[model samples]
Target: MGTRGQSSAMGREARDPRLDAVIQTLQEIGNLMGRQAQERAANIAQATEAATTAAVNGNQANQGQAQLKPPKFDGKGDPEAAPRWVEELEKAFEVLGCTEAEKVTLAVYLLQDNANDWWKATRGRVFPEGTAQTWAVFSENFYGKFFSESAKERKLAEFMRLHQGQMTVDQYEAEFARLSKFAPRMIDHPEDKA
Candidate 1:
């Protein structure tokens, strides 16, 4: 009975170091897993925060755009109406901090009746698939369609023939300002404009 007890005690002593090593390994593995879990959770949190920020920014932009009320164009009325509509739309775009794409999109959205029909017909020709839709391009197409060369030439001639003779100072200044838009190069310098 004594020998059996001593052997059992020796056996337990021999297994103690192995048990301790297994326990240490298990603790190390658990710590590594915990760290990995923490890292994954942090990544998820950051991604969620980024997504929320993007959504908020998008909503703010939408709100800003919603506040804007650009005038509609029907491609009728005075020939000068085209330039006036463009000017108003440009001002609105400036206030809204619109990108070039946004400018074209919003301008197109404001088009009604004949103007909308014209854009629909011209869109395919002006902007092919995979081509960049730019404000400059749209402007060129719009001016080409609405503003005739004859009308531009006539305005230029009128600007060249303008004079302050027999007119009030205010009237002359107003007339000069109105016609000068047709010949920008003629009054490009401030001294020349004066």
Candidate 2:
């Protein structure tokens, strides 16, 4: 119920009438600044909300477009007759000098055929009539057809020492190609195995 001398929330002594005029102007400036602050806060909230909504909308639209669009394809031409891995396998085959490589090459071109017969044909060594030594027979049937005489003797001696005069069917066929680099070519065959 206080009137002219009432204190405000700051609890200072009530302003006098002459000073009240200055207080009233200061109060008006404070109200104006408060209103300006409220207006600026409202504008910032609206702008932030609008930016968030726009970003969400943009993300949703991008996701929808991505789902609807087909993948970009070269479709340059029909694929080659075989997959590219086949070519790599063929290249690896060239470096391999053994029966497995030869058999694998045959199988690939034969349209998924097996080399059962090729294995069977070269399976056992045939000891020729004239020679007591079975090594010559092993060489002719398994390795390149003709080996130089010295190369033949060196190989036969190694084979006898390793196998102790007994050889398995497929044993020498595997190692002979790798070992025979020093062994001269017994026969000259064309590169064209076709």
Candidate 3:
């Protein structure tokens, strides 16, 4: 009777094949789930890093644009003032890294009094509905209204007649710089400009 009881205890302690299979399967599932969770965490971290980079870049661009302070134009000064204002505004645009479309928009915003009125009248002619707006188009129109052909001819003549005689070196250089804009073709090369 003691031997029978021992045998019964041994049978009770024996492992089942089906139960062992089930345990192995559960461990495999847990390992697979762990790998999947790690991958998901890595993907989320990458997306978060990308978003942070884009936000920082956007903030930097906004800060640069904010620092720009273009001068205004009222179409009431010397005809040369028109070209000078355009030059100043272009420098501001370069510093701000503005797009061509942005250049036209910002340039238009700086127009005041007669200049604004001129734009209002000329806008339709230059930028008909459905036409793409560009800095070149805006510049052509603005120059047409403010800087006349006659004024440009006068500037070109002044540049052609420029001489260093009698004037100080600095004065001659200043006058040359002032008149050079009218004849860009003549000074297209560095040596020619010099």
Candidate 4:
């Protein structure tokens, strides 16, 4: 009876030791797998962040390149239809790399048929003939012929009479600032400006 009990006890001890060793080996493998998964996740996150940053940097570089090389103008304008012809023309001149001396001739070339008529009629009347002038002179001459003093005065009066109707305070302030450029002499005091 003692021999039989001892053999049963020994068998139970052997099974317990083997089971414990198997459990410990499995736990170690699980821990190692968890660490590897964490490392993989971190590496994937880092790669995603780097790719996003690279895309943004590439966009910025493209924008910088675009600014360096200005777009070409097709020289299309109408004084009555597009009232801001002078502004458009000036932008085009800057893009086309036109010098101050070449501006007048380029302006003449780009003028629509009707605008050319006005230019011819008002060239000497507004500005002297054959003047070696900047784009500013040409702009003043062209705009002066079309935009009369009466119109400027009307615009200035409208700007002065502006109200913050149906607009937020920020919107009203922006509108006021925009209109103020039209009538620089009207608002002398900063208090009145506000």
Candidate 5:
């Protein structure tokens, strides 16, 4: 009876080693899967942080550029409108931080009534479209047609005669800057410009 019992116990010990190996393998697999899941979660978190930082930086840069309100156009370009429109439009561009190309296109759209028709039919060329060419052509056309040589001469004379008057230093400087465009030739030296 003792020999039979001993043999049965040895058989049971042999089966237990195989069951222990299987349990150990399952635990190792579970630990590997847990580590992979943790790594994936960390990656997702890092990506989300980077995206948020980029969006915030973009908003800040845009704010630094231009947060100005949109402008309404009264139309009626060139000649009669040249004086006021030049000042007003340039100011609007500064406020809005528009590109030179945008200034040209916006100038066209701003024209009202007869001006738009005249420009589209006769003055505005279509062959050289896009930013650089359009800006150059439009500037040449606008200054030549709208602002006549005689008118520019008169503005130059006015610029020569201009003084500070009763205005503040800031106001005087602004007026000088505005008038300077008419007599660009006078500004030959850096000291003269200053």
Candidate 6:
């Protein structure tokens, strides 16, 4: 009976040792898997953060690059006129691709037409900062370059002729009436106000 009891105890010990080994192995595997999962999560988080930063930076750059000048029309007689005309004009001539100078120039001309030379009286109101010259202002307003040089010269000569009090009122009126349809409308050329 003593021998049989000893044999049973031995058998139990042998089985238990195998079970302990299996549990230990499984625990080790679980720990390793947990570490791997943590590493994977960290990597994914880092990638996502980088992508978000890049997207935000790209959007910021685009906003800066897309800067365009605003269109201008003279305030004419409006007291609370906008100050964006010259600002927009500068941007139009900027090397940026998003600016349009011609429309802004025409808008400025229209404003001058409305003001009927009153704009010059309020030069501070119309041209806040820059003391822009007439031809330069017109040239920069939209054309971004010089006007048709010959046509400009001819027009200027005619303007001088008309303004020097050489032409009769009727002749000047008829000639200007013809010019009104096609000539670049001026802001403060005494010819118009006369």
C-alpha lDDT of all candidate models, in order = 0.80, 0.42, 0.82, 0.64, 0.66, 0.50
Q: Is candidate 1 or candidate 4 better by lDDT?
A: 1
Model 3: per-residue Cα lDDT over 12-104, one tens digit each: 679687898899999999999899777755764554455456556767645544334557899997999999899888877665456677689
Give all TM-scores, in the order shown.
0.59, 0.23, 0.61, 0.46, 0.44, 0.24
Q: Rank the candidates by lDDT, best first.
A: 3, 1, 5, 4, 6, 2
Clashing pairs in 4: none
TM-score of 5: 0.44
Instruction: Compute the lDDT of residue 120 as modeled in candidate 1.
Output: 96
In the range 96-191, model 6's lDDT, one tens digit per residue, is 222233333434454544343544555465356755335344434333222234545565556545551687888878877644433454534547
lDDT of 2 by residue, 105-136 (tens): 33324332222343345444343345343323
TM-score of 4: 0.46
Best by lDDT: 3
RMSD to native, candidate 3: 17.7
Off by over 4 Å in 3: 1-67, 189-194
Candidate that scores best on TM-score: 3
| Tens digit of per-residue lDDT, candidate 5, span 60-157 | 64543332322333444434356556566676566544566667766777776665775777543542444264555665676666678888888888
What C-alpha lDDT does candidate 4 achieve relative to the native structure?
Answer: 0.64
lDDT of 3 at 79: 96
